[model samples]
Target: MDTLLSSIEMLARWDVMAALFIGSIGGVLVGAMPGVGAAVAIAIVLPVTFALEPIVGLTALLGIYGSSMFGGAIPAILVNTPGTPVNALTTYDGYPMTQRGEARRALSLAYSASFYGAVFSIVALMLLAPFLAKVAPMFGAREIFLAALLGIVLVIVTHRGQVLPAAILACLGIFLQTIGIESTAYTQRFTFGQPWLQSGVDLIVVVLGLFAISQALVLLMGRDKANDLPPVAKIGFFSQMKDLWLYRRVATVASSFGVICGMIPGVGEFMSQFMSYAYAQRSSKTPELFGKGNPEGIVASEAANNSVPAAAMIPLLALGIPGEELTAMMLAVFYVHNVIPGPQLFTQHMDFIYALYLCLFLLNVIVVAFLFFATRTLMKVMLIPNRFLGIMILTFSLIGVYTLRNSMTDVAIASAFGFFGFILKRLDLPTSPIILGIVLGKLMEDRLRTAMARVREPLDFIDRPIAFILFLMIVLAIAGQVWTVVKSRPNRKGTSHD
Candidate 1:
């Protein structure tokens, strides 16, 4: 109660209120714009968070993270373009609905589904967080090291079709992070002789380059096309709200998938949304209608994706491990503010946790309300030229990187990464694993080194029961990946013979 009261006092400030308002609305705007993903938007602003008060800065970022998906559906439903990468699944059902003149209903259903997901994940976080705090400390350095290994392994295998590319990129990220002088031995591994390399790579600079700058290049290089908005009908919000109960089963299941994926390191909205959509399709009596404007499809995708932002924080806040790329960036903000997340955070900063939960809950409601009333206005945002938006994002990226240290070297580094990011996009490879590798690489190294001081044997790393279980899970995951590849060989061989 005291913590809640303290948080309430802290949140009453005007700057916090402004942060919530601007971040939510801005998130929606950027999300509505095609090719401008939430990750890019967050990356552009990550440097600015360093200068603001911790609470104020965090609240603003949280607001953006929480609401962007709601805006993401706008372009998906109307323009058949996904505003954010994760909204790609939403396009399968949303765009078809728009073409059939049910645009309003599709948007409404998407929003309602998002609400169901957002609320469920928030409640789960509230209920599970304290319990997580209690359990976080039971695992030691070896367990954490194993957990980080599991995260890296999961990042590779979860790419499904692009497993090899993801592994290579993850290794590249780990290697990049190891470039500077060693934290323990003080010996440089990859610097070669450059003064800039001595300090190693900056996470923000890398993020700005790979995501923000690279995305800008893609946008600028690509020609923009104008899109026509489908006409929307007037629909009562309350009527649409009541219609959601019919999908409670699917909504509940999808939301559960979101929370579960959000909690596990490396499994993100992509997995949750895909699994939910697949399940919904498999279970529906009218499965044929799934890709053809099915309301259930919208629910499955939106609910699961929206649930992720809050649930992804579970591992971040409880264990200091990021569940996805976005959370990895958010972890940077936590570090900048000197607000470390983990078990000790609960005992030391319970108020911040409670406040953050409340803030997410309210921001969600505000986003739904704002998006509901501004539906007509938002569809118009889709017509803005992608090239112009790309230029603006590039400008923002350069400025943000420059301000970090007022250094030209950082700007150049970011530009190089930007080109790399563009190449990844061109080659159709995942960029997220690299970020994960960078963030988790440092973590795994530190934990492993700490654990090795006492235990040197390979088998000794899994002596703890929890560590053993995690190691087993990692083994099973690898075996499963191999089996999947091996099992597909027979089909290919038989087809060749035929």
Candidate 2:
């Protein structure tokens, strides 16, 4: 009760409220653009956060995180191009609904589901984070090592069809993450006599390269013709509310899945949205209508994507382990304020922590209200020419990458990754697992080494129940991949019979 009261009191302050408002607007703009995601947006703004009060910094970042989820849905509904990968599932139903003259209904369903999912996850974060914090300290080197392994396995398994390519990319990402000076041994793995490489590749540069610059190159190559979006009709809020209530069960299930997936490390919003969409398809009465404007599909995708920002914070706040790249950046913000996350954060910085809860609650309300009023204008951005959008993305990617360290070397790195990203996209490879691996690699390596060093025999590290369980999961994931590949192979006997 006291914590809640303190948070409410802190939120009533003007600076925090102003930060939230500005951050919300910025988040929406960034998210509406092709290829710009919340991670890139937050990364570009990280240096600015270093100058602000801890509460203010957190409030701003939270606004960006929450609003970006809804913002991504805008492009998906209007243009059939998802602004972020998390919104990819939204396009499966949202764009089709727009083509069917149900644009207003689709947009409305997305907004409502996003609003509800965000608010529900925030509530869960507030209620559960403190208890989880208390339990986190009990996790030692062995447990942490196993948890990291589980995260890697989850990413590989979730990629499904392209598991081998994903695994290769993941290995490459892990190798890249080891380029910087080692925290434990102070040994540099791949600095190669370059002073700039010693600090390693910036997360912002990599994300901008992979998502923004790569997308711009693709758009530019295909800019010979212009593509336009359908006209969206204005619909009443009550009508949209009716639609939402009609598909309440789907929304609930998707939101639940989002919270669960978000709580796990490495498996973030995209997986949640994908899983929810699949689950909805399997259970829907009108499953065949899913890609043809089904309201249930919209509910599943939007709810799951929006729920992730709040729930993804669970691991970060409780265990100092980020569930995804965005939350990992948020951890950097926490460090800037001289506030360490994990078990000590709650007891040491109670007011700031609780205030974050309040900020998240208010952010959802503000984004929904803002979107309701600006839907008409926001939807029009989708009609912009691909060429112009490409130029804008390139400009921002340059600016965003440069802003990270004001170094030309970072820009060069961005270009390199951009080229690699374009090739991966053309090949139908999954990039999410690679990003996940890069984000978790250092932590996984450190924990594994620490756990091994604690035992007389390295294999004895798996004697713990947690380690054994995680090892079994890794085995299962590999087996599942093998089975899938075997099943997909053509049998000579069957081919002859045919």
Candidate 3:
């Protein structure tokens, strides 16, 4: 009751409302552009938040977090490019819908799903977070270690078809995590005395290089000429609303999947969308229609991706652990304001947190309202030339990386990752596993060290119930991969025989 009242009070403030509107609009615009994500948009805006109240600052950040999902679908539908990595799944069906002259329907589905997912997840976060926060402190080093293991296991299972490559990338990411100084021992693991390397690689730099710069390079490699986009068809707002109503169950299921996946640390929008798409494919009556202008695919992907921003906030708000790169950046913002996240945060700053929830809800409303009025204008941006789009992406990529710490070394690091990303792309290697590994590596290392120090026998550490469960998951993942490989070998052999 008190929390709701406090949220209402915060919403009544003029500055808060203004911040929400501006932030939502900015987030939508930034998210709409290919290769730019909420993280880059928020990082660019973080410094400006230094002047605002805590609630206001968070309102702006949350607005960006929520609306960017919708923004990502813009390029996905129009240009066969995803504005964000999370939106990559959307491209499979969204672009196809556009190619069939259903751009407006695709856009409409994306906006509706994004709005519902964001709103639903925010409601879930508001209701579940406080209870989750109460339980978080009970998690010891062993449980955390198990949790980290489970996260990595899910990554492997989710990318099962390419387990070896994913494992290799994950190990490489873990290796990157060990590059900085060891916190407990005060010893550098892989710094090699270079001052810049001491900080290791920024996750943001790696993500931008892999998703943005590498994508640009791939785009440039494909052709010097650009493909023409289909003309935008007029779509009635009421008609779109009816279409969304028809697929409410699909959106709800996808949003639920997203919320669950988002709650798990390290797995974010990418896995959520993929999982949801798999589920949708299995459940849909017209499974063949998927990847061929299926509206359900757009609903599943968009809902899941949008839901992640809110769901990812769960661990951040409750346990002080960010689930992905964007939330990690948001965590820094909370630190800047001296509002440390975790159990103490809810009790100490309940008003602000509630206000943030309200802002998230309102931001969704704002985005939907804007999309309702300006869908045509926004869709036109999709028709912009590929070369011009590439230039803009490159410019933002440079700016976003430079803004990380205002360091030239960071830019060089980004370029280096760009080259590596290009190589991985050519080899058809998944970059997501590398990201998962990099983010989870340090956490895993820290927990392993702590558990080893406490256990009399090293093997005893794995005997814990949670650890055992994680071990089983790892076994299952490996077994699954082996089975897939064995099955493929026979197919190749039969082809040779034929």
Q: Which candidate is the best by TM-score?
A: 1
* TM-score, every prediction: 0.96, 0.87, 0.79
> Candidate 2: where are CA atoms >4 Å away?
224-239, 278-285, 335-338, 346-352, 490-498
When superposed on Cα atoms, how far off is each prediction in RMSD?
1.8, 3.2, 4.3
| Model 3 global lDDT (CA atoms, 0 to 1) | 0.76
- Cα deviation at 349, candidate 3, in Å, is 5.1
TM-score of 2: 0.87
What does candidate 2's lDDT look like per residue over 347-384, in tens digits?
66667677887787788888888887787887665556
> Which scores greater on lDDT, model 2 or model 3?
2
Residue-wise C-alpha lDDT for candidate 1, range 50-166, written one tens digit per residue: 898887888888888988999999889888989888899999999999888899999999999998999999998888867876788776788877777888899899988999999
Ranking by lDDT: 1, 2, 3
- Model 1 gets an lDDT of 0.89
Off by over 4 Å in 1: 234-236, 491-498
Please give the RMSD of candidate 1 to the true structure.
1.8
Which regions of candidate 3 fall more than 4 Å away from where they truly are? 6-23, 35-61, 78-106, 199-239, 265-297, 320-324, 328-355, 396-406, 448-453, 459-498
